[model samples]
Target: MTDILVSEIMNRLNSLFPSVSSELNSINDYTFLIAVLLSAQTKDKRVNIVTKELFKVASTPVQMLELGLDKLKEYIKTIGLYNNKANNIINLSKILIEQYNAEVPLDRDQLELLPGIGRKSANVILNKICNAPYIAVDTHVARVSKRLEFTKNTKVNKIEEDLYKVIPSEYHTIASNLLVMHGRYTCTAKNPKCSKCILKDICNSRNKYF
Candidate 1:
């Protein structure tokens, strides 16, 4: 049952979203990480809007360090938690420069050790930046997993474990992006687009129909 469901979900999401790249392509690696960090409690659309200007000013660790805390805050003032996030960005930039030679570490452990990055953010970097097999379970991914009965747990780490238990490693990236996108657009929190959902037939969600 898990195998069949996973296969179907992958097909449907892949058909709708052929690729999940190009989201942070415009920015350098350091700026991309900053954008992802700033994305917490914020929308990607908003992040894009702010990053367009922020990246133009500081696209690297040294550049970001030179941008200063107040100026950094000003650039990302539109984002939620801008104050704290700006602090993390500055401190992390300093650490990256001092420790990692100003390069974003590819290792999850090293990356997580940096400020403004946790397990989920590290996982996202691992999957997207390093092309590693990691599925970062955000709120949308967790909701979709529960609704589909793909994961019985509500905790992000537990849900991620459940997904890894059943899902093949090769499909991790696609699966994560697909589930996140699906929950965002189709199987949303309110009034899910059941009629248009390809996985509706297989979905065990209680709120299937509008």
Candidate 2:
């Protein structure tokens, strides 16, 4: 996409969702990291619901370890992949306490080394917590990018790379959040509100309803 088109897209999305940010509730950085970890393949609203009780008992790495796997599972059982997620949470908390001085690492590589954190999760932590310039690609971001013709790539990593080439660095921090919010509420998987979209005129998707 051209710079002018990218700017117009960004401007419209920012206007539509001006205060777009992470919806996952957390008490602190540690809880935020844990919340993001649990959000894989699950909605942020669901993760927030689970974390409401979970964080009350265990908000830190040490406290999370004390919560133990069984109790942790009980707290997050409503979320998908709870069993594995519980295990990863407990294990990652242990690593944080032991290796990182009970702190979530700012480094993407170190964050990725954790049991549940992959590139996408690591990118989120880095961008939101550490103020690093990285576009964390989730299903929403990928869908919006393709629909906008920012990229034809299907793989998350390649799409991310393509987005970096098209979108300026100054907009990287809010890019994913804007796209995610748009895809979640407007350009949804089915029956997208094309008629109401500001970018409907520029949208290249063949599936535009209008």
Candidate 3:
């Protein structure tokens, strides 16, 4: 049952968005992790805007530490939770320099130990940088998965487990990208474009709500 649903959604997503990946607009692990952390409760466009400026000044752990929390806060002031995120970034940068030799830890466990890096953020880092088969369940993934009947639970871990069970191993890397795009553009939280959605036939939330 789960496999069938996964196949249906994958097919529809492939047709809708052929090229989908980290639209956070980053090129390296450091930038990617920073972007993901700043993206908490913030939009990709905003994250991109801040990261563009932040990275120019501090792209490495050494540079980040030098920038200091106060300066970092100023740069990312537009993002949500700027104060907390600034502290996390500073602490995480210190950890990276002291423990990991200024390198982003590849191990998910180690990554999670960083101040701002949670399970989802760690998963994003591992999947994007280390090619690990991890699904980071953000708001978009959670909403889309529930609406598509992939899972009835709102718990992020449960949704991730269900997604792994349903989606094919081959598609895991692309699945995150595809689902994120679907949620952002078509299956939005408010006023979803169901009429324009290619998965209108399979999406459980479409006709049932409208």
lDDT of 2 by residue, 23-105 (tens): 88988889999999999999999999999999999999999988899999999999999999999999999999899999988
Whole-model lDDT values for every prediction: 0.83, 0.90, 0.86
Top lDDT: which candidate number? Answer: 2
Q: In model 2, state the lDDT of residue 128.
A: 83
Of candidates 2 and 1, the better by TM-score: 2
> lDDT value for candidate 2?
0.90
Q: Pairs clashing in candidate 3?
A: none
Q: Candidate 1: worst 10 consecutive residues by lDDT? A: 20-29
lDDT accuracy of residue 167 in candidate 1: 74
Instruction: State the lDDT of candidate 1 residue by residue for 95-160, as single tens digits.
Output: 999998998899988988988899988887777877788888888888888887787887888999
Ranking by TM-score: 2, 3, 1
Quote the positional error of residue 208 for candidate 2 in Å: 3.9
Native-to-model Cα distance after best TM-score fit, residue 134 in candidate 2, in Å: 0.6
What tens digits encode model 3's per-residue C-alpha lDDT throughout 98-134? 9998988899889888998999999888888877889
By lDDT rank, best first, the candidates go 2, 3, 1
Give per-candidate clash totals. 0, 0, 0
Candidate 2 stretches with Cα past 4 Å from truth are none
